[model samples]
Target: MREFDVQLLTDAVRRMAAQSNQILSPDVYAGLVRARESEDGLTAQSILDDILRNADLAAGKAMPICQDTGMALVFLQVGRDIHFQGDPYEAIQEGVRQAYEENYLRKSIVKDPLRRINTGDNTPAMIYTELIAGNQVKVSFAAKGFGSENMSQLAMLKPADGVEGVKRFILKAAREAGPNACPPIVIGVGIGGNFDKSALLAKQALMRPLDVRNCDPFYAALEDELLEQVNNSGIGPMGLGGRTSALAVSIEVLPTHIAGLPVAVNINCHATRHAEEVL
Candidate 1:
């Protein structure tokens, strides 16, 4: 088996945590550029322009893109043939703690759900690990701001509800999110998994590059169709009204039991900050 040091994971996560907050990933930036060009309304076009300027300013100034620097998320895809030398989970958390403290990003995490006490350092990152083949490990990090996060929703639909029901629910979500999600949003959708996994899949979908489509042709079409419908909702940039309510809609799906169909929607604002590293 190949052995890897946990420190590598720590350092990668730390760098991504800080970098993602300050810069928009290339795919996301490209999507915004395209959105700005496609918008016909002057209000929507101007809003998209401002959004692009903000991204540029954030990177040039070496500052966080949005005031809500977001909760740190670390996703690990580890190979079955590899082993970690130290505490990988703890290392990930430490990476988040150090990045937030050193970079002066907002520490929004709470130690307790009910009591809501500040964690102070943003420790206990939301980490997800998946084991696959090969000897390499992939680390993906995202700074998930809660403005659009709070607009997300989940539903357990019957198999009988079918695709149309799914489309309706998704469109309704974009409609209701409106300006609240900070329009020109990126939509991540999870379908056909168990309740919790579906939600996790939706969150992970946001990490997919905006330029990439699902490998499955059907789901890829669904993603395209959903993105079009959402933009047609007339939410526009910053919801003032126009043709670009969402930049992209990414759909991630998994096989599911015959009895259940779980769907989740995770909305991300225009910033859509994410980064990835392979080791």
Candidate 2:
């Protein structure tokens, strides 16, 4: 069995938090470039151009992509063959605090949900842990800003609603979110799991690269078909109206109880920021 230092996990999380805020993934960048070329509306095209330029500036200058630096959310997969040297949770939180302060990331997290007092250092990152079968620990950081996160939704659909119902539900969610989630978006749809699980699944789906699809052939086809339908809405870049409002539609599915079909839709703005590291 391999023993890993908790400090390494903490440091990696911090680095990921800092990196995600400044860099748009290469796949996302390439997709946006393609959209800029094919988009017909001059105004819409201009908006896309500005977005690309801003992303470039963010990376080059080491500045946060958006003013909202976002709350840090870490997901970990710890292998059964691995042993941790220190307190894992504290390590993760310390990493989050140090990263935000040192990287100059804005501290948007509040201490009390009801009181709304700013924590000042973006500490207390939301972390999820899962045990797996390897000898290494894999950490992924997704800095989710409140603007787009607020626009997400979960629906407990009737069993009779079926796949068509799910399609309509997601479209309606997108329509309601109009321009708020920052157009030229990447949509994550989670279906079949319980409400909370479905919601988390949708957000996690955002971490997958823009061009990748579900390994399941059926879900892959659904992802492609959904992307086509969402783009047809003509929400365009930044809601200016064009053929490329949404860059991709990704879905994650899980088995559910026989009584209900729960669907969750998580919308990520053009500035979707995520990074991962394994140790």
Candidate 3:
């Protein structure tokens, strides 16, 4: 087994937190450019252009794309062939706590739900772990802001809802989210899984490259169909009204119980801040 240093994980998370706040991935930038060209309405085109400009400024200045730096959400896949020398969660939390304080990232998380006191540091990140085959650790950081996270939803539909049901639920969720989750969103649809799996998959879906396609042709077609329908809603950029309601729609599926279909929809705004590392 390979022995890995916990400090390596801590340092990686720190740098990733800084980088993710400033850089908009190339895939996301290209999607906006392509959308701007195809946008029929002048207002929509202008909105896309402004977004691109903002992205450039943010990166050039090395500033966060949005004021809400977001609560750190880290996903880890640890290989069974490797051994962590210390408590993995403590290492990650320490890294996040330091990153928030040192980087001047917003401390948006609250310790008490009812009292609503600031946590001072964005500690206690929502961490998820999985055991995989290799000797490496893969970590993905998603700074999920409250506006979009609050808009996430889950539904336990009758098995008969099938694909059509999923389409309808997604459309409704996006429609209700109108302008709140930040328009021109990247929609993550998780289907056929249990409630928790569906939610996890929905969050995981956001990690995909903005322009990549599902390896399965069937899922690819579904994504295309969903994208077309979502854009047709005319939610536009910032919800002002246009053909660019959503930048992309991704669907992740898993086998489910025969009795029910659980679908979760997670939305991330134009500032889809995420970064990944392998150690």
**lDDT (Cα, tens digit) per residue for candidate 3, span 185-205:** 999988877989999999889
Worst 10 residues of 3 by lDDT: 21-30
lDDT by residue (126-156, candidate 1, tens digit) is 9999998999999999998899999999999
Q: Is candidate 1 or candidate 3 better by lDDT?
A: 1
Off by over 4 Å in 2: none
Measured against the true structure, the TM-scores of the candidates, in listed sequence, are 0.97, 0.97, 0.97
Off by over 4 Å in 3: none
State each candidate's clash count.
Answer: 0, 0, 0
Query: What tens-digit string does per-residue lDDT give for candidate 2 at 1-279?
Result: 998889998889888888889998788899899899989899898999999999999999999989898888899999999988998889999989998899889999999999999988898899999999989898999888888888899999998999899989999888888888888888999998798989988988888889999999998998888888888889888887998878888899999999989999998888888888988
**What lDDT does candidate 1 reach at residue 80?**
97
Give me the displacement of residue 56 in model 3, in angstroms: 1.1
> Best-fitting candidate, measured by lDDT?
1
